[model samples]
Target: MAATKERALEAAVELLGTDGVRALSHARVDERAGLPAGSTSNWFRTRRALLGGIIDWMAEQERADFSPALLERPTPETIIEGLCTVFLLETGPFAARTRARYALFLELAADDELLAPLSRQRREFERWTDRLVTEAGIPDPVPAARTIMALGDGLVLHRLTVDPELDARPVIERAVRALAASVG
Candidate 1:
């Protein structure tokens, strides 16, 4: 079951990341994941179920990677900027394939059934930012963190929809600087 489920996730991420996820299918996933045919349904019972499982598991993986404890650095601004840096670094050439995969992961949000998990993940990330905002003794930290999230989201949207070539570093740096100034 574990192996099968893992394969399903690998397949889903692969499909969703490539081809805009509009073409994600069990057969295609099986080929991409190198799993036996019908394994996705064997584990998730349905397409939505499979997508949800992967989404949830990925959230857990990310939460583990970027735990609140990862912010042991003294300054909230530095910590927040460091967090963005991770995203910036991760989306570079080394992770281009994975970024493509992430594009597919996010496409699930368009489906109401699949969107539930995505929303939950987004909220969890926002709460982490909200906590930093509160701890930093900044005004309207929730909104501040939310704006950052929105900017990041917009950047991703732009990358996915408009221009994959557009550089997001400058804008991210600007926002982080502005937010830091606000908090300081």
Candidate 2:
């Protein structure tokens, strides 16, 4: 039963990533998950409930995937590299999940009720970035953090469609350095 729920959420992520929000449905999730026809409905009961489950599932996956050691790095370069490594899907492991997250973000923008989790995530990221930038002795930590995050978002979005083959490490390093210098 637990495995069934896990497979349903994983299917939701894959469907959202590949087919966009409009393609999500209990039947589709069930089909994708290879579960019985009513499995997703049995678990989620309603569209809203299913969506909430997906959001919760995403948050849990992200928390599990994140590395706390990345946050403890003392140098800005190392910190930025660690951050970019996740954003760029450098190991090719998180590519689908990352794309699904972006797709969910777009969907969240249009639905106010679904925005809370994403909003909290964004605020948490901003806070973390602000702390990191401040530790680096950068001036205007808030603005610097915002700029760095925006750069990362733009790069990820662009990479998703424009050039999946592009190496993002060098680009991310240069951008982080330039932004850090600007605030220094």
Candidate 3:
């Protein structure tokens, strides 16, 4: 049997996509997981732990496909395609729940409820981002990552919301080429 804590985190992660942070609650999570009442608290002991679990879960899912090979043999096309795939995942089948969790993360940013795990992931994320941006030979990795993240996020959001059948494949390819050109 999956631990109640794991189950709760999964529920919270799923809920984040559509509901945002405010929607998370022990009651709602338990219900979402179809667990018996009180199971969430029974396992996690506190709401803080539960919230931390969700952040950890999200970070895990987000980077599941990343590898160092991409850095060793970097290609603008691959970097762009890899990022686009991750971006699509965030906005599509898994989006609603991530949205809900993100809302909670934003609401509880100052709270220790999500500090440790999220911090760990943030460090790793920055490292990976640095690799990609540096490999691209960009002037600044921070700005490069920020620009890429923003562009990809907007594109995915538009693809998911404004246009049901938006053909972003060509756009993505072109954009990657442009980014590569800026580097060279």
Give the Å error, residue 148, model 2. Answer: 0.9
**Of 2 and 3, the candidate ranking higher by TM-score:** 2
Q: Report the Cα lDDT for residue 181, model 3.
A: 62
Query: Which is the winner by TM-score between candidate 1 and candidate 2?
Result: 2
Give the winner by lDDT.
2
lDDT of 1 by residue, 1-184 (tens): 7876776676676566556456667777777888888876677777667666767776776676667886654265665566566555445432433454366456654677667776777688888878876676656677778887788767766665678676777787787667767833
Q: Write the per-residue lDDT of candidate 2 for residues 1-184, one digit (tens) a residue.
A: 9999999999998898878888999999999999999999998999888988998888778767764557785457866777677775622676667777777788778888887887777677777778888887667778877888887777777778887776777777887777767733
Over all chains combined, what TM-score does candidate 2 have?
0.90
Q: lDDT (0-100) at residue 17 of candidate 3?
A: 59
Off by over 4 Å in 2: none
Which ranges of candidate 3 are over 4 A from the true structure? 1-4, 65-72, 110-116, 136-142, 159-166
Highest TM-score scorer = 2
Give, for candidate 2, the lowest lDDT window spanning 10 residues.
88-97
lDDT score, candidate 2, position 78: 68
User: Scored by CA lDDT, what does every candidate get?
Assistant: 0.66, 0.79, 0.69
